[model samples]
Target: MIGGASAYDGTNCKAPGNCWEPKPGYPDKVAGSKYDPKHDPKEINKQSESIKAMEARNAQRVANFKKTGTFVYDVSKIPAAN
Candidate 1:
């Protein structure tokens, strides 16, 4: 790599690391993270929706990286905190 920069993982994130690692308790059905069918319905449902959204976003980032070698950020895409 030029300037000795390490290979960028999907979204310019450092490769060979757990940058893609999900939160401990998250059950990502798409990313194949731990999934407990017996998990509480309320918690699972809530987590599932948010997890799915995040997975979609990250997948897009990875795809963009594959196409352009980096993720192009647009701050307007993010929702502001309350």
Candidate 2:
């Protein structure tokens, strides 16, 4: 051991401050390998709908500006229920 008796155990670390093994009881598989949003059909559909809504809003804004010849600012109410 370079630093101390527990610094570089051959089964855990190579030398001082170098560890090769995962923490005890950690998952063996890689993170996000399962249940990733990119691989989920429902998540993909929801994301597609959100993107479509955004595009529609942008198109509406562009059309409004073209028709009125001025920029319109939509200020949301602080407490939307009001």
Candidate 3:
């Protein structure tokens, strides 16, 4: 027998089953196909560089606002949030 109920039994599960099996990690890559960063280290580097640049830009904006009391993107033009 596969536990208590066949599945849903009207109000409750007459026979609740296990949630799911735990795997090492990843589903698509399990079939011996994984994305190796070694093959595209440059792309990885580019992604990292993009993140750093974004953080730096955000930091600069915050600093500018603290000093000049203004946002990098003009929110004054937009209607005030309700």
Instruction: Quote the positional error of residue 78 for candidate 3 in Å.
Output: 20
The pairs that clash in candidate 2 are none
* lDDT at 52, model 2: 92
Better of 2 and 3 by lDDT: 2
True-structure lDDT of candidate 2: 0.59
Report, for every candidate in turn, its global Cα lDDT versus the true structure.
0.61, 0.59, 0.59
- Candidate 2: worst-modelled 10 consecutive residues by lDDT: 73-82
Candidate 1 vs candidate 3: the TM-score winner is: 3
- What digit string (tens of lDDT, one per residue) describes model 3 on residues 1-82? 6877656433432344533432557453434456333456787699889999888767767766776786865433433335
Badly placed stretches (over 4 Å) of model 3 are 1-38, 74-82
Residues 1-82 of candidate 1 have per-residue lDDT tens digits of 3887666554433464546654556653534443544566788699789999888777766666676685656534544434
The alpha-carbon deviation from the true structure for residue 73 of candidate 1, after best TM-score superposition, in angstroms, is 4.9
Model 2, span 1-82: residue lDDT tens:
3675644355655665666665566555555654333556787699889999888767666666776676554523112322
State the local distance difference test value for candidate 3.
0.59
Error of 1 at 80 (Å): 22
